[model samples]
Target: MDGKKVILAEPRGFCAGVRRAISMVEQALDYYGPPVYVRKEIVHNHHVIRALEGRGAIFTSSENDVPEGAVCVFSAHGVSPEVRGNARGRDLRVLDATCPLVSKVHQEAQRFARAGRTILLVGHADHEEVEGTLGEAPASTIVVESVEDARALDLPPDADVAYLTQTTLSLDETAAIIGTLRERFPALAGPATDDICYASQNRQNAVKALAARSDLVLVVGSANSSNSVRMVEVARNAGTASHLVSNVEDVDVGWLDGTTAIGVSAGASTPEFLVDQLVDRLVELGYDGLEIEETATENITFTFRPVWQTEEVVQP
Candidate 1:
């Protein structure tokens, strides 16, 4: 609608993990010449991936596709032990970019397996993170993506049970799934701390706050981005009409037909540039005013430098 206001959510776009992953690729490119191979989309943001690609990083779906001795960086989603082993067998110089939170899940999985417990992983079956975590203890872990899955999961009668979740998931939905799991497995052991990372929870909370005050919500993120997709769901669940767009081109003008207030938020992996582009597009589409809703402040940062660096700056 003409002369409508656009509300933006703070703590949107680029979580610490995504920032670290991108920086890993950039640093790798700078430290080790061109063609630094990365396995999988670093963080599911096309713009971020393209920016790195332009800077001479090559992305591959499998380690086998990479030259044996070339430096390879794993995606933020993390990788299976099998993938790690395969890379090691090939003697690939590896730099893991898995988020520390996700690594926490992996460590829990290892502990549960070592304790001879059956692990229930709460996430989509095919997601790279789930696949990697599943690989952690394939024989002892089962993937459950929904409350329904939790309800119908048939586990060994006497098997000790525990659960770990994907870092980026709809908070309420995951909570419901966990509720069902606890109901069924009275003895289930969950993470000592919540597995859903702080960034995911904060972003969703921010989007819910933005969606409540706006007539419509626009989520800036790739379709495959778990956190971005969950943000859209969170907004809709808050009773606001929400659309998840990869970029300005994906924003449907028809959704603005009668909306007077629109809110914009980005996924953890999305770059600020894409958010700016989306806001600019909204202005072009007749939303002239802008307001930012600050739900929380993010002071967290992560950094990594080569072992040879004389001085490495790690921020928090």
Candidate 2:
């Protein structure tokens, strides 16, 4: 493994949305002091959660878990209108940390519904984001997870249809599904812009590039992370063996058999340290040489600091 080269994919991990969400939690902690309640893991990275927890952030599954008047934040995945209402009803200090990209999807769903078009959502049924988007207009919106679901869909004969997709989806697969939907419903209206966010698309594109050049591709992201899962699928789709491992510990030495060049990338929620640790582990396994394949450059940044931090302006 000493002479083997490890190809790292650029434009991986901690997209603008994830960065904003995590910063929201940290800013809440800094501004309001600890015990700031978060509705869910701000991002999917365990290390990020643990770090925030250490700073007095409380992660819970529901608004009820937060005390009255407690500062509560919605996770990056976004929440349903009902959830937002429940938080408001509970008198919680709500600071939404939903990724703007996801919020855009929600808005699109509402727009289509308002226009009298039946909305089709391309995503897993049970995912939190999907649940939230469906809640926007459950009566008018339908969830289509695959081409099979698209084919089997039953809708009003005279209904106009529009489609919106989850931000973190396999680009190639989603395109196929979207193509099928367009074929079946020639007049189906899609989002004014691409539903898949730039970060997700760029990461998938990076993985595709890495997979084509490497013998094995290792994606660093939690199993439940949609973008991470799609990265693995993207690599496999490119004819390379791939695996989705959450962290360094999840790597099995046996997977490295006969592998020369190993490609590494991470989900948007994943942190850079995790990728670094994975590279270290790979080095330990004898893949010492390192190279980076820069597929795209990301310069996007989001800034929304808590009120307290903004007030502490000191003139130089």
lDDT per model, in order? Answer: 0.89, 0.89
In the range 141-242, model 1's lDDT, one tens digit per residue, is 999989989989887544589999999988999999999898888888888999999999999999999988899999999999999999999999999999
Q: Please list all clashing residue pairs in model 2, or write none if there are none.
A: 1-286
| TM-scores for every predicted model | 0.95, 0.95
lDDT for model 1, please.
0.89
Evaluate residue 298 in candidate 2 and report its C-alpha lDDT on the 0 to 100 scale: 99
What's the distance in Å from true for residue 104, model 1? Answer: 0.7
Colliding pairs, model 1: none
Candidate 2 displacement at residue 266 in angstroms? 0.8
Model 2: runs farther than 4 Å from truth?
A: 156-158, 305-316
